[model samples]
Target: MPISLSRKFQQWVSAKLDLPEDVIMDIPRITMIGHLHLYIENHSGLLSFSPEEIRVLLKHNHGQMIIKGKDFVIKTILPEELLLEGTIEMVKFIKE
Candidate 1:
C-alpha cells in the first residue's frame, strides 16, 4: 500500500504531540443533528447550494460532500466551517 507524504507527516506530528489526527490533517469534520442540521468543518469552499441539494468542496482528496434533501438552507458560512439547515436525506462524497 502506498502512503501519502502528507498523511505520514500528519501521523508523525499527531503522535509526537498527542493531537487529534483529523485536526492535524485538516480533515473535514461533519456533524449532523437528526438530519435537520449539518455542520461541516475544514471545508475548502462551497461548490453549490440550493433548496434540494448542497455541495461543498472538502480538503484533500476527500472530494466534494453532497447533501441531498429538501428546503436546504445555509445558516452560516465561514472560512473553515459552515452550518446547513434542512431536511437532509442523504450525504455522499464524489471524488474529483
Candidate 2:
C-alpha cells in the first residue's frame, strides 16, 4: 500500500518529537496480562469471536489480528477498544 503525504508527515513528526508511533500512526495497542487477560486499543472492528478464536480488524494498514485461546470471554467491547479474558495460546497478525 502506498502511504499518503499526511501519513508521511505524521511519521516524521512522531520521530522528530520522540513520540509514540502507534498513537500517531493509528496502530493497534495490545496489552496482555499473563495468559488470561488481553486488552486491545485502537481497533477498527471485530471480525469474529468464539470461545477458541477471536479475530479483530485493525486501522490503517495494520491488517488483522487473530487470537487463539481456550474458554475465551469478552470483558469489555467498544468502538475502538476490546478486553478479552481466557487462556490465550497464540496471537497472529496477518496483512491482507
Candidate 3:
C-alpha cells in the first residue's frame, strides 16, 4: 500500500514483461513533434476540448493534462490513444 512497495512491484512487472515502467505504472506517454503535433498514449478520458485548449484525464494520480495552443484539433481518438495537431504553446499537468 505504500509508495515504496508499489514502486518495487511496478519495477518487477516492468522487468518481467520487458515493458516500460510508465505503461505498467499507469502513466501517460506523451510525444510531441516540434510544436505542431502531439501524441498521447494511455489516456483515460478527455476532460475538455477547444481550439485553444485541451484537457485529458490520465490514470493513477497523474491527473489531467492541459494543452494550450492555437488551432487545436484532434486528429484521432481511440480507446487508449489520442493524436492532436496544432501550434502547441504549452503543456501542463493538473493533479487531482
Candidate 4:
C-alpha cells in the first residue's frame, strides 16, 4: 500500500511544529555490515532504540534489532527518507 495522506500531513505538521517526523514514505534501502549490524534508509515511524531492542515498522516489514545497548541514532531523516544505524536482530516482511 501507498503512504497515507495523514502521514504527509504529519510530516507537514512536524515541519511546521519544528518536530521530527517519523515515517518511511518511500522505498527503503537496507544494508547489513559484518552480519552483525544493519543500516536502513528512508524509514519512518516511532523509533525506540535501547540495549534490549530496536524496533521499526516500514511499509512492508516490521522488525526488531537486537543490540547490546541503546547506543544508536537516526543518522538522517528527510521527508522522503531516513537512516538507521544499529544491529538488526529480526525482520518480518508483511505481504499486501
Candidate 5:
C-alpha cells in the first residue's frame, strides 16, 4: 500500500509549485508544507482527509484519525473525498 502521486497530479503539482517532477513525486516519510499535511498510505484502497480528520478504509475495522486545530477548514468535500486546509496543529492515527 505504498501511496503514489498520480502522473497527472505530479504534473499539476510541479507546475503549481515550480518543482521538478521527480521532486514533487518523491515518496516522503512525512510531508507538511504551510498548513497541508499529507501521509502516504502504505496499503492501497480508499483514502479520506479533512481539516480535522483522516479516515483510511482497511481490511478490518475502519481506521479513524483526528487533527487538532482551530482554523481547520475543509476546502472541498465529496462525501468521503475531501481536501483539508488549515493550520495543522496535530495529527493522530487510529486503528479500529
Candidate 6:
C-alpha cells in the first residue's frame, strides 16, 4: 500500500522542521528512569496491569509493550500517557 498524502506531508514537515516523529506519527515514546520508573507517551491502550507485569498497546498498529517486573504500581495515567513505578526487570516490544 502506498503512503497517504497526509502522512507523507507529515513526514516532510517533521524532517524539515526537525520535529519528533513520535508526535507527528502518533507513535509511542517510552522512557525509563533507572530501574524503578517507566514513562510512556502516546500509548493507545492498557491491555493489562498486574503487580508482576504490564502490557500496553501502541497506536497505529505498533503492537504491544510488555513490562515484566515486581511490585508494580501506576504512578500516572492519561489519555495518551502512562507512568509506572516498579522494580523493572525487563521491557520488550512485540510488533503486531
Q: Summarize candidate 3's per-residue lDDT along 1-96 as a digit string, tens digits.
A: 699898898889899989987768867899999999999998988999999999999977679999999999999999889999999999999888
Per-residue alpha-carbon lDDT of model 4 for 6-34, expressed as tens digits? 66776677778886444333445566675
Name the best candidate (by TM-score). 2
What TM-score against the true fold does each predicted structure earn? 0.85, 0.92, 0.84, 0.40, 0.40, 0.86
- As for model 3, its CA RMSD to the true structure in angstroms is 2.4
Residue-wise C-alpha lDDT for candidate 6, range 1-96, written one tens digit per residue: 356887899999999999999978987898899999999998988999999999999988889999999999999999899999989999999998
Model 1: per-residue Cα lDDT at residue 29: 95
Clashes of each: 0, 0, 0, 7, 2, 0
> Residue 55 CA error for candidate 3 (Å)?
0.4
Instruction: Report the CA-based lDDT of candidate 1 relative to the real structure.
Output: 0.91
Tens-place lDDT per residue, model 5, 1-96, is 233346577778889989865355532223456656444332223355544555444322325555565455655544334345667777675666
| Residue 8 in model 3: lDDT | 90
> How much is 63 displaced in model 1, in angstroms?
0.9
Question: How many residue pairs in model 5 have overlapping backbones?
Answer: 2
Question: What is the TM-score of candidate 6?
Answer: 0.86
Error of 4 at 73 (Å): 6.4
Tens-digit lDDT track of model 2 for 1-96: 356788889989999999998888878999999999999999999899999999999988689999999999999999999999999999999998
What TM-score does structure 4 among the candidates reach? 0.40
Q: Candidates 1 and 3: which is better by lDDT?
A: 3
Off by over 4 Å in 6: 2-5
RMSD of each: 2.6, 1.6, 2.4, 10.1, 9.6, 1.7
Q: Rank the candidates by TM-score, best first.
A: 2, 6, 1, 3, 5, 4
Mark the regions of model 2 whose C-alpha exceeds 4 Å error after superposition: 1-3
Q: Which digits, one per residue and each the tens of the lDDT, describe model 1 over residues 1-96?
A: 355876788799999999987788887999999989999999999999889999999988789999999998899999989999999999998987
lDDT of the candidates, in the order given? 0.91, 0.93, 0.92, 0.53, 0.51, 0.93
Q: How far does residue 1 in candidate 2 sit from its true spot (Å)?
A: 9.7
